[model samples]
Target: MGRRSSNKQQGGGGSEVAPVRLHIDPERPAPRKLEPAITALRRGHVIVYPTDTGYAFGCAISSPRGIAMLRRLKNMGERDPKPLTMLVGSLADIGRYGHMGNAAFRIVRRLLPGPYTMVVRATSEVPRGMKNKRQEVGVRVPDHPVCALLGELLGEPLLTASVTHFEDEQFELQEPEEILRRHARELSVVVDVGPLWPDPSTVLRFLDDEMEVLREGKGPVPD
Candidate 1:
């Protein structure tokens, strides 16, 4: 019973489908554990992992395989466009991924380092999951360390995918270990480095100096 081996409940799905899972983790970043989590993503598995804002279900943002797996598990409609959010390791990547300005900076300045999602233009490397109905994408740089570390280790932005396990769940997990085991085989890895926020990031669309509230929870948007 190594920490890396979480319990993966066999979710019910079509015989040909792989069940999506949720994972919890220990309080340390064991390379042994992280490697499995990363492997899960590399293999196209959908996962429920913790982030700065809360516990989000996500996949490797650049992997179509991971995105498709999430789309199937989410039972999203064709017209849904499969939009997802990118969790960048730092503020620098936001420019590489989207066009930003003083306005975008101000908006991000207040809400970020916490729970907030900013919609921006899609770069060539962005995953299809983040694209809008017409190909736009959302990006976030969380104030949490574990998430940032994971992004750095992966050498890419993280995809903030959604899950419905808990009703109105915030940006943190209470029983991460159990969660990890519940979705063991289905997850990339579970990293519970330390304490984390228990809410989701404030979500906003910032483009051309305008702002729109996609979701009104966690961090609030100013008028």
Candidate 2:
């Protein structure tokens, strides 16, 4: 569980507070131990947690302040072409946020819960700030248990930003303590599951029943 300390850093303007660190088993995350992180998310606070690809910065989907902080952290502008990705619990949640055709759905059903990011038309449910100029959004269903449980407990998709080293984009922050050392000022909580190497998710775009590979990474390209 997270410490009882305050976790209210907002849009890079608030006083710096020590981020609460919660260590949970990556293979079998206990819900009881996750309550504090859940509470922080409900309050629209940003968190750092492990994902199938790597660790990512996360916040509730409906948080404007959280979104602002995320964009600032990523050095992204208001009209940046790159859309933010969301972590969801299941395909059903993906459908709720994105418009996936039958063909796209079939492909996603097969490859998801792995390391893949599907770009699709966003539904009205998605916040405008999270979409790209094409009105598309990136969505993921990570195979990691901690990510799965976080989505399940939050009851909605979490807006995510990849945690990359500012000095070297190629380097990944593998340890929770290192993540805290660098980002404690901006985050509310850090969900630790030991070290994990970076392996970016494969990004694919689906439009008009056609599929296009945007960026190939960890996930294998489908035939």
lDDT on C-alpha atoms for all candidate structures = 0.61, 0.85
In model 2, which residue pairs have backbone atoms overlapping below 3 Å? Answer: none
Each model's TM-score?
A: 0.74, 0.91
Q: After superposing candidate 2 on the true structure, give the runs of residues whose Cα lies further than 4 Å from its correct spot.
A: 1-16, 165-169
**Residue-wise lDDT of candidate 2 within 177-212, one digit each (tens)?**
787767777888788888889788899999857999
Residues 21-72 of candidate 1 have per-residue lDDT tens digits of 2233433444544555565666655566676555666677777766666666
Error of 2 at 135 (Å): 0.6
C-alpha RMSD by candidate, in order: 4.7, 2.8
What's the distance in Å from true for residue 167, model 1? 8.0
Q: What would you estimate as the lDDT of candidate 1?
A: 0.61
Winning candidate number (lDDT): 2
